[model samples]
Target: MKNIYTLFICLFLASFTNAQDKFLTKNGTITFFSKSPMENIEAENNQVLSIVATKTGQMAISILMKSFMFEKALMQEHFNENYVESDTYPKATFKGRILSFDKITATESATKVKGELTIHGKTKEIVIEAQAKRTDDAIVMSGSFFIDLADFGIEIPSVVKNNIAKKIEVSFNFDHKPYKK
Candidate 1:
């Protein structure tokens, strides 16, 4: 009877250790900026879902297109109905790995990430330079990258093309806690 009890305790401990290697959060934030000579546009979304596997350096992020908020309702409507077609493609996602995973320690470190970004039903490979810091309870990751609007099948109207930049700057920040279950 004692031997069986010991075995159960060991198994439980092992499972708990493995759970510490993964982190997740459902309220990450992602922001985008478009700056041109004519105008500057910006939007932010705080309903981003993200996960990081520390043991393998794998990461995934998902954000609802409609979650992005703009200062102007007209701009938001145009962005959803025409630019992004949010009804058809409701989400954007990124799946990739952090390079040199083993070197990431508790201190803040600079790293490179190679991943595939999917937006508007199109996928493209992208590399981003990011900063990662392991806190006492969470791993905070932040980065910015530029993406061409045309590459994602996002077309701007000719009349307003000058108002939008050809390339958009996107930045993200995620504080991931150990995922339970």
Candidate 2:
């Protein structure tokens, strides 16, 4: 009887561990805003793929460069052709993990995520104050932060330098389902 009870406890713990190991998102959005005195530009990528594997502490996120839609066509063209060079660098990706997962509680609503963001082939360390909420069948992670264009090798033309903000606000809303594999 004792052995059977121990086995039941182990199975329960194992199920929880498996539940926390993976996350999937089918409707994820990443949005950014660059405000200037002359004009404010806002863009968003609705089809974003993000995965967070808690067991390995591995995270991978990617967004198609062309997915970013701007209100102004000219601005969008220039962004792809010049600053971002979307033709060559077609995707933005980040490969990192949460620094301290052991200290995080499964039922907690918010936690600090410390990881690295790679954009334009440059990696930068970023700490995001994020919130993780668990639903009936999914886990949602959301966060907002700012990044400097220069830090990612994105250059602004001197002619329009003042027209763009140096730092841009970025926000992420991800609805993640459990990964089976």
Candidate 3:
């Protein structure tokens, strides 16, 4: 009877030690900027949920399409209905890993996180130089990267072709908390 009890305790502790480290945030923000000769356009979504599973070196992020807001309502509507077609494709996701997880140290510094980003129903590999810092109880990650609209099948009308830059800059600011299983 004592042997069985000891085995149970050992198994429990082993499972706990092997559990993955997770962090979650719903108030994260993802913003984009597009520069054109005619005008500059910017949009942002604050309801982004991101999770980092450290043990597996896996990270995932999801953002609601309708959460993206623009300065003009018409632009916002068009972005969802015409451009993104949010009704059909409601979220954008990325499921990848930090290529060099072993090289990362628990300190305030910048690291390159390479992963695959899925946007508009298409997946593309991207490398982003992200700044990371370990706070009191959370890990804060921020970075800015560029993406070409055409790469994701986002069509640009000829009338406004010159106004928007080919490459759009995307920025992310996330505060993640440890996820306990």
Q: How much lDDT does each candidate structure score?
A: 0.84, 0.75, 0.76
Against the hidden true structure, what lDDT does model 2 obtain?
0.75
Question: Could you give the C-alpha RMSD of every candidate to the true structure, in order shown?
Answer: 8.9, 10.2, 9.2
lDDT of 3 by residue, 93-175 (tens): 77667555545566868777778888788889988888886544777789999999888888878876897788999999998
89-113: candidate 2 lDDT, tens digit per residue: 8777766665555454447566667
Better of 2 and 3 by TM-score: 3
What residue runs in model 2 are displaced by over 4 Å at the alpha carbon?
1-20, 99-108
- Cα distance off (Å), candidate 2, residue 61: 0.7
Question: Which pairs of residues clash in candidate 3, taking residues 3 or more apart in a chain or in different chains?
Answer: 22-179, 36-163
lDDT top scorer: 1
Ranking of models by TM-score: 1, 3, 2
lDDT (C-alpha) at residue 143 in model 3: 93
Model 2 Cα RMSD, 1 decimal: 10.2
Better of 1 and 2 by lDDT: 1
Cα deviation in Å at residue 108, candidate 1?
1.5
Worst 10 residues of 2 by lDDT: 4-13
